[model samples]
Target: MRKSRIARSGARRPAVATGAAAVAAALLAGGFTAVPAQAATGTDDPAKALHLGPKEKLVPQGTITDADGTVHTRYERTYDGLPVIGGDLVVQQTRDGRVQDVDKATEAPIKVPTTKAKVTPPAARRSAESLAPSAAGGGSPIVQDQAPRKVIWAAGGKPVLAYETVIGGTQPGGAPSELHVVTDATTGRKLADWQAVETGEGNSMYSGRVKVGSVKIGGQWVLRDQDRGNMQVFNMRGGLDEDSAPAFRNAKDVWGNGKPTIAQTAAVDAEYGAAVAWDFYKKVLHRNGIKGNGKAPKLYVHYDNNQANAFWLDSCFCMHYGDGLDNKTPVTSIDIAAHEMTHGVTSATAKLRYTNSESGGLNEATSDILGTAVEFYAKNPKNPGNYLIGEQVNLLGNGQPLRYMDRPSRDAEANRAEGWPPSADYWKPGIGKEDMHFSSGIGNHFFYLLAEGSGKKTINGVHYDSPTYDHKPVTGIGRDAAVKIWYKALTEHMTSTTDYHGARAATLKAARDLYGTKSKQYKAVQRAWDGVNVN
Candidate 1:
């Protein structure tokens, strides 16, 4: 199902919330960005979940159509006939008709002295452009194009008549940005100001016998990717910080001896992984680089002594790899490298938290999904791609993969001693409550089900048996299609608070956008979620 790309602004709305009811209490606690409400009852006349007083009016502002064809209508509120500044709210309903009252403000109704603005609109516009934030938000100001809009500033503690100004500008990195400033109508004083543009930064190794970028520095060939973001691999022997761990520089162009004894061996792996991962994002996914910026991030290898792990640090905007037990094996395999780097991508895109039940699992699962995609995209004959995480590292020293997507529970007994609980093969209530690495099975299973479909299959010599929760058969739409849908959802649709259900909706929406709502791929997404019991 291919549909013409059509963009429609503005909206149509009917009062209602869909899904579950407990979300009402959770919303008040800020537990969810959007929740399944009570729209399960009726579609024609959805129940008004938002209990607005008679004096208040809900003015529709914008709308978003989800992949499942559910309309999320955004609205602004007015009290006593005056618009409430920052009183933006959204009524989100999923395909199943689960609706919820989603809004930023959960405080009591606001009361302003009057709707009259003492400060003239022209004066407000002038101040909006001239008033540089007390602290630089890091940008040269662009002139505000529109006039200051009059509204009641009830978003803050107390309601006050005010003028809201939208100031345009470019961020330090030249990304277009907007600064929203709210000023008190009575006085010209700035009440609040914030940058509306968001930017995130964060980047990886193991590959079997691979090609890497090198640079000539002081007559020495350094492990730096001059071609791709200058991604350098540093030797973090034991100390922390880049100061102690200088980058690997070889007197000759040749690097590594294919043995763990040679320090450059691990560096070779890390550097190659970084180069491949970088190319994977740039060529395969069409992402320029991590954070979608062309600049490459730093890489730290041989992280801690005998520390069998690897990770990405968004703060340092670098990827770190550790040596396995006895410091003989480095955890810088292709999948490991792509996996850690994908963490940074997740940070930059959805900004998913590293903690929490559902979101945390999603944050980790995202890395695994994209990492596998990068591995497959690389098409390395030596390291053929498989639906396995950390397959090359041998973390348990048993030749067993870290987490198995087809049947996540397979790694249970092997990794159990490492404090990993048995992973769920399918979604169940509280599945996300497990360790993220294990809980991620729900998403992992969904992806596998989407990419390869259910039951027995073999790819790259790796056999897998994936089962459906309801014992129903699922037909795959192709690995490429599944990867595309997941990527689109993660970058464009997913948010920080997205849970398994939300993830399903986001992917469905992505599939619909890419293949149309009625396409086999769209139906595959639904079937995949059903296989995982997400719906």
Candidate 2:
């Protein structure tokens, strides 16, 4: 959910298709692998009942029961007792055990032998290092154990015996790197490699010097919340290296002076954002934390020199923020904080691929939706909840917000006439070329229409003019109900490869589960999708 610069063009490009093709090519070239598929006609446990092809065994990972009593079961695939790296799928079934849908990452069969590989572990390590020299740091690659597994070589090609090697080191750009290299075990030929690092970026006492949880350890007041599972915030002090950053401590619990001149100001903001986000999920959604396991993620503020972005790194299991615009504006606003952490939630739950168009767009939209929800939940007087994202941060430097959910097209800088990107009004073929941030407008616009309806309106002293692609007005379902439907769809209905159409179906199912099939909310969900032209 990293927001990059927007592409200002009306050209129609198939970025998603092209990116998917690139991913497939990477898989064949030994860069990344695909999961296996499971098709079950009977029983609730698809992992036990589904036919996963020769020598393959599916292990149930997790199960989510929808409001309507339907079950979505996730499974990990293995071949001949060896774990398959990318072989995972979800099976949907009704309360009576009737199978409704089977969402699989790959449908290929795995029939590879699990016998000891002909190639030595040293040789496999050398092969992986050769494939990713940047990960070796011009020295010996810290390769982990080589596990034998079955992986799909091509789109429909038969599964082959491969050695999955884990290489750990630092990349050339100084970022921590962990590469998963797949090599043909019999021939020692490299198949694919993928970076496991999930990069993301945050702010200050911008929430108006609010009370933060702190503890006095060794007579020093530390930014550690003992109440919230000892969650701690560290001050990077404009440093790029995270390992060396120190925690912000003060003589008294009071921190920040409403300005970035004081380092604790940003830490105060970050700590506050984390606290609110944690409470929002716990209280509003009944989820414990980002991973829903009652554990807190590391928070680091003032990362890098004048860094203008905030990111969440899976490798560190933490969130980092950069000071934007002369190192004064911190990106740690409540919505932005919630947005970045939501990426972590998405990673733990759906595990959606960030490169695929539809899934990637959905991924970004999910963050925006939940982040906005967090803002509404907080109701901070200094930073009141609104449809505008990063409004207080002034990321653009012109005082305009980073994005506007109520009117997504209004984000288009060049085409101010229509207030939207030229090709984003409808979900047609090839709209994927639009940046994930921009393509996200499609979903954002849909949510706005669903929650507030179409046309012009003003809320919280903010003006918004929204329009439908088909000129069909949608009835408002209110943000609270809409968010519940979305959360259900995201946590219970969505899979790894869900696209816009999949999202529409998932939301409809969520609505049916929550409000019944014939309820107004169910119909509103459909109308909202239609308004965005997702249907």
Candidate no. 1 TM-score: 0.65
lDDT of 2 at 334: 85
Best by lDDT: 2
Backbone clash numbers for all candidates listed: 20, 22
User: Over the stretch 32-85, how does candidate 1's per-residue lDDT look in tens digits?
Assistant: 123233332234322234655555655443344555666554444566666665
For candidate 2, write residues 202-243 as lDDT tens digits: 222278858788999888899888767678898888775677
Question: Candidate 2's error at 535, in angstroms?
Answer: 1.6
TM-score of each: 0.65, 0.78
For candidate 2, the TM-score is 0.78
The local lDDT score (0 to 100) that residue 89 gets in candidate 2 is 67
